[model samples]
Target chain A: MNWIVNNGDLIGQLVVAHLATAIPPIILSFFLSIPIGWFANRFQVSRGILLTVFALLYAIPSLPLFIVLPLIIGTGLRDPINVVIALTIYGIALMARSTADGLASVDPDVRQAATAVGYSARSSFWRVELPLAGPVLLAGIRVVAVSTISLTTVGAVLGIDSLGALFTDGYQRNIPSEILTGIVVTIALALAVDFLIVRIGRLLMPWSRIVGAGGGRSARRQRTAATA
Target chain B: MNFLIQAFAFIFDPKHYGTANGIEVRLGQHLLISFEVLVIAALIAIPVGYLIGHTGRGRAFAIGFSGGVRALPTLGFMILIALGVGIGLGAPIVALVVLAIPSILAGAYSGFEAVDRRTVDSARAMGMNELQIVAKVEVPLGLPLLIGGLRAASLQVIATATLADYVGGGGLGRFIFAGVQTQDYPQMLAGSILVIFLAIASEILFSIIQRLVVPAGVTAGRPKDVRVKSSRSRAALG
Candidate 1:
């Protein structure tokens, strides 16, 4: 652990860089996917095409995407933003599927009930549909958060700097401790972020917490199945 | 667009196709590593997953383990293993196998888990042995989901196998890494394209297999079910 102690400041900086690189894509993808997901859900005709495209997008390896993205977007080869943009694309691809599935999971009868109560399309969506879709959306976002956080390290290969920098540096220097630290920290950060998302979800959707508390195994199964 | 042309040119150049480090050779290496890792991981994981799914005995542990595995950074794993083992196929193979195991395990068991319990009960009612039931009932019913798991595992392995080059475990990733050092954007892009092509080819191959494997009567609902569950692996896709 002397490596960590001697490199405390460097570790701190890398952690910050990692978060900066990871969080934007997580947040951006979560918000952007909701609408795209809604469109897919709203227009049944487009659902298949949209999902297939996103799935293909996700299937592209991150390194190649990182290499080719600059060509498409004109970022410099080593630009940190290239990593961010590529990750956002992946996050959207993933979250869009989740969002569409989340939005689709809403009960039609409940939506009709909201309409009968005089909620407009927009109002009902924000109020009735979005809230009802919260559990699945939350699950989707959690996955996005974890995966994006883990993926931010790929930027290190390109010399863009992040927690992943430790990996390359450690490998070059033959410092296993540093690589271990990066792996542990990355996983910790992901799980911690996931925990924070869950906490925030509980706070924002108090009713879900209540259902979670009372609904027992069946509700839990339904949630898993929804995301499934 | 210019780089795209350069990349295609790099890919098509006959001069780049045959030597020790040729695209074809690296591509073959890439596929070989991925195939070996997948086969080994499947051999290990599928049975454990099957037990978990069949008995419902370790579902929670399986989920927790896979979820945690998903959170791991592939680059970190590769670097660490390569350092530990002094750089060889052992490192990449070990790392990639670890990466492949979770999805396959998830698939094998979840495939069994997804089977209707009532069907198992009926099979039992018919005096079928556990092995016979699994073979005739659970395996047949769960083939699509099992295949879905394999497909996801294959994609992630193929994609990450590119990184195998990072640690001297050579693959198509050689082009990407070699190009990066020389600033040969075309080579890097070409490597990426080749990997993407492999991923897509496997995807199509699996989808067709997934379709063909479904027991005839259950075809209507199983494909869609498999599609939705395909989301499980994206968490580990990175």
Candidate 2:
């Protein structure tokens, strides 16, 4: 309590830094994934290739990626941009797969119906396909948001600023409260962001609330679609 | 490209292998620690998961629990544990196992949940004991999801164990951390490449295991595409 109170301004600054590092990757990955995910979903061969590549990209550990990425992209070793770029890579890796899977979850007949109604490929994607995949995509984004917020801390060890600075500082200083503060704040931020995403999702796609609430109906519909 | 070539050279150099703190030794320690953590986590999680799946209780708790735990930052979690436990492999092991349990628990229970209720009921109607029913009916069918959980757990543990080195938990991560301190970019890149290889190998190995475990009769009539869809969806849930 004393540590937190005394260090209030420092903690505030850290939170701001954390948000700056985390949010861009979340938003960038969500938008960029749609096209990549759509491309993956559109072709049979490319789906396997793209998903595998992204999965492999994700398999690389964060610290190492932070270290090596600068060499590849010509950022300075300690540049905050390294964290942002690395996190965006991680975010896209997870979201692209989710995007592909979410898009895949949409029914084929629904696509045909949109075509019959004279919707072009581009407009149908924006209007019909993306909207229908909203729930699953929202689920994917929620995961990305939480994971990205947590991962931003990894940058602290590399000397990039974030809430994670507390962990290293606290550990070296032997102050357990500061470490606890970092952990608590990070988790709280993640859950709060997650809640906000859900709220936004509810506003954007009011229909999914009903489908999500009555999951049994959708499950049954999917079962019948499978049978048909 | 020059950096890449230097990293490969560093990896290929025979001087880095064998003996104390060699690449091979660090690699072995990394694998051993990951294996130990996975085993401990599985022992604790699988039985609880079984109970939940069998009794159809705690499903909501399990989901919420895993979700919250997943939000935890691994690096901070390790540092906190190391501070309490006073810095050793023990701290990281404890943290890693804590990190690993959620995925395995989800896997074990979800595997059982995936079994059709009608199938379990039929097995009961035919006078099979609960244990027999689980072993014969559920285990075989739920194997894929269980393995899926293990795959997720392994990937997570492997990635995280690298961070463990930050607190003096020895592994291949030593190279990356040590390289960072000395500004040795090639060495850092080399360590990253090795870890990536190990992770990808484990992924391929688990996938093969997943394919092999699918009961022949169960998957026989299903299209390959549907099989892929089911496995991927289960992954998305994780």
Candidate 3:
């Protein structure tokens, strides 16, 4: 009660700042990792190593990355740039592995058929493989998006003025609502972004849903059985 | 060069070995917090996941809940609960339990869901009761997936529990927070290193458990029914 009315402006600023820090990495990593994913999937020699690297990167604790990023990238400890860079790297690590896995799952027959249909390698990938890979890739992206949203708040530890500032401020000021607002808003933002990505994936590949619906009960069962 | 030297010294200091501020004390805190959270999460999530997956009615709930939990920012959640519940270890444990539940739930239910329908049917024909069938058939078959979920959930608890420092719940994160405040990069690095070691060690520990628990047939090279399961805690080969 007192937290919101008195700190309404502060919450608003934090939300905006939080979104600002969170979005760039999500967008950047999507573009950045697709190529990296493709390269990993295409090359037989380095697939294992590449994936292992990403997995290790993914496993690195977020707090350390947040702390260590400034030293690696030559930014101030509290700089939002440090947060963004660290997050972008984390996002890339997450997205690249999924991208590789997605691309790897595309049917060889479908790929050959695409090539046989007078498509160049470039066109075949963009038109054929990429679309085929969308559902899995988008599924991975949903996790990453949700993950990034959650992780972005970790940056506030280093003094980035994101929604995490609310946590710090609330704790400092002894205000529960401020902290509550931060939690609700952060979850809402994550859900909204995840929903948007899912919708966009659906729009991008209407045929998948049609195929899924047409495939009948067991195929759908298998889909549900795949786990998160 | 300086970073390496200082970080090594920071980690290896003798006085810091068994003191209140020692890495061992913090690591113990880390393990205790993670263990409590993982136990609580498994109890709730595994049962719920098994029931829903066994019944096959709560797929939507399971899926939606998994996504929703991932989206929950831990720091805010921790602080929010801490403010409401008041500080101590309790708030961080509650927050970590929230963070850990989804994958565990997904794993438990999906394990049951993935069991062969024919096997269950054959067991029914053999005059086995529902309890007997689940206890005998489903439990063994679904153990791998359950272990996988436990694997992910445990690591998540270990990784995320570091945030406990923010809410005054001490762990390795204390070093991280303290180091940052005082510009003690070596201490910060040491803390982060210890955390990473624990996380990786836990990962290896669980995978080994999974290998031992999962049967030879299930873990064997059966590429049939390949599906992408990008659960938050997917295991990776190092």
**Candidates 1 and 3, the one with greater lDDT:** 1
Q: Order the candidate numbers by DockQ, best to worst.
A: 1, 3, 2
Residue-wise lDDT of candidate 3 within B1-238, one digit each (tens)? 4775787788889878788878889999999999999999988998788788667678798788777777778888888788788778989999899888888887777777666666677899999998888788877777877887888888778888888987789999999889888988888878888888898998789878776776666652121223424232222211
Interface RMSD, every prediction, one decimal place: 2.8, 4.7, 3.2
Model 1 C-alpha lDDT per residue in residues A26-108, reported as the tens digit of each score = 99999999888888888767898888888888888888888888898898998989989999999999899888877787788
**Candidate 1 wrong stretches, greater than 4 Å:** A216-218, B225-238
Question: How big is the positional error of residue B229 in model 1, measured in Å on the Cα after superposition?
Answer: 9.3
Ranking by TM-score: 1, 2, 3
lDDT per model vs. reference? 0.86, 0.85, 0.79
Better of 1 and 3 by TM-score: 1
Candidate 1 lDDT by residue in tens digits, B1-238: 9889999999999999778888889989999999999999999998898888777788788878888878999899988988878786888899889889888888888787666666778899999999999888988888888898899999999989988888999999899899989988888899989999999998989999988998877853376812334223223344
DockQ, model 2, C-alpha based: 0.53
- Considering the two chains of model 3, state its CAPRI-style docking category: medium
Instruction: State in Å the error of residue A192, model 1.
Output: 1.5
> Candidate 3 regions off by >4 Å?
A43-46, A206-228, B216-238
Tell me the lDDT of candidate 3.
0.79
- What DockQ results do all the predictions give, each relative to the true complex? 0.64, 0.53, 0.56
